[model samples]
Target: MDMEERVVGEVLVVRPVGKRIDASGSADFKGKMVDRINRGRNLIVLDLSDVDFIDSSGLGAIVSMLKTLGKKGELRIGGLKETVDSLFRLTRMDRVFRIHPSAEEAVLALAAAKSMAKAPA
Candidate 1:
């Protein structure tokens, strides 16, 4: 799992430099994300532009990581290739998870949601 992470002001921009996110690669990524979330850095933007394929295990790992982040913080996926996007659609995970058309847009949207939640109702 080749990855690069940086804090863009408030959001963590994590880009994986890989063509495929298989079981092995995904497990490592999940562990890293869980560790990050546990340490209180849960807001994340996953750039999937370079990732072309993801198997069932990979998708499951992503979902589990998102669940761990929960409501306090969230994981947003962006830059999905058509093939991977189709897989998410087929599994109905597209509706379950936040899919962004672009990483920049996702960062803004999720950040907005977070800010709104903090506002008084």
Candidate 2:
């Protein structure tokens, strides 16, 4: 499973290049994401536009990544294609994640959230 990692301001955008994220690749995906979180990348946007398929293991892997953040950071998902979007909706993962239409929109949303967090109450 090949992934592209980039920084959009303070958020790290991770885009997996593969068409499928199944049991064969979930472990590696989780490992890489954990490593990134350990390295202090707390703000993230997972861009899944290129990915067309994911299994339960893949979904678990993503949920694991969110847990790994554990109040230290945020993980937003974006660019979900129709089938994947349906899966997320069906599984109720959409409610668990802040899904966006594009990576740029996800980054902007993160930025806005950060700004709001920094605002005085």
Candidate 3:
């Protein structure tokens, strides 16, 4: 599992540079995410542009990450390929997460939300 991590104004952008996230890569993906979370990086935007295929294990790993984040953080996904997007929609995971058209949009949206939360009422 190859992943690139970058911080975009409080949102951690994680781009997995792989064609598939199946049983073989799920554990590595989950471990890397957990390590980041344990390191105190909360808000995340998973960029799946390079990922063309995913299996149940990959989906499960993502859900697990969301659960681990819980109330302390947010997990948004972006750049999903058509097949991956269909899977998320079919599994109703799309409703469970904020799916963005692009990573830039995801990061900007999260940043805006953060700014709004900190604004004086």
Candidate 4:
């Protein structure tokens, strides 16, 4: 799986340029995410606009990424196609991830959350 990684403010945006995230790409996807997290990227936004399909392994890899982040980081998903959206909804993974219509929206939301966290009580 080929992914483009960039930073927008404090969020790390990872856009995977692949039509399907199945058994073949799941490991790569998970590894990329883990690498970002290990490198001190606490805010991650996955841009999945190009991904049209994902299998159980792919979903499991995403869940594993979330678990790896734990309370130290956060993961958000954006630009989900119909097939991918249905899979997430059907599997109740939508509730586990913060889904957005676009990567820009996810970045904005994450930025707001970061600001809020830094705000003084």
Instruction: Choose the strongest candidate by lDDT.
Output: 2
TM-scores for every predicted model: 0.92, 0.97, 0.97, 0.96
> Can you write out model 2's per-residue Cα lDDT over 12-41, one digit (the tens) per residue?
999999999999999999999999999999
Q: For model 2, what is the C-alpha lDDT against the true structure?
A: 0.95
CA lDDT, every prediction?
Answer: 0.86, 0.95, 0.92, 0.91
* Model 1 Cα lDDT, one tens digit per residue, 1-121: 8888888667888888888889878889889888878988878998888888899988988898889988888889899989899999999999988889888878898789888888999
The true-structure Cα RMSD of candidate 2 reads 0.8
Lowest lDDT sum, 10 consecutive residues, model 1, at 6-15
lDDT of 1 at 45: 92
> What's the distance in Å from true for residue 14, model 2?
0.2
Q: Considering summed lDDT, which 10 consecutive residues are worst modelled in model 3? A: 108-117
- Model 2 TM-score (2 dp): 0.97
Where in model 3 is the C-alpha error above 4 Å?
Answer: none
The parts of candidate 2 lying over 4 Å away from their true place are none
Ranking of all predicted structures according to lDDT, beginning with the best and ending with the worst: 2, 3, 4, 1
Ranking 1 against 4 by lDDT, winner? 4
Candidate 4 runs further than 4 Å off: none
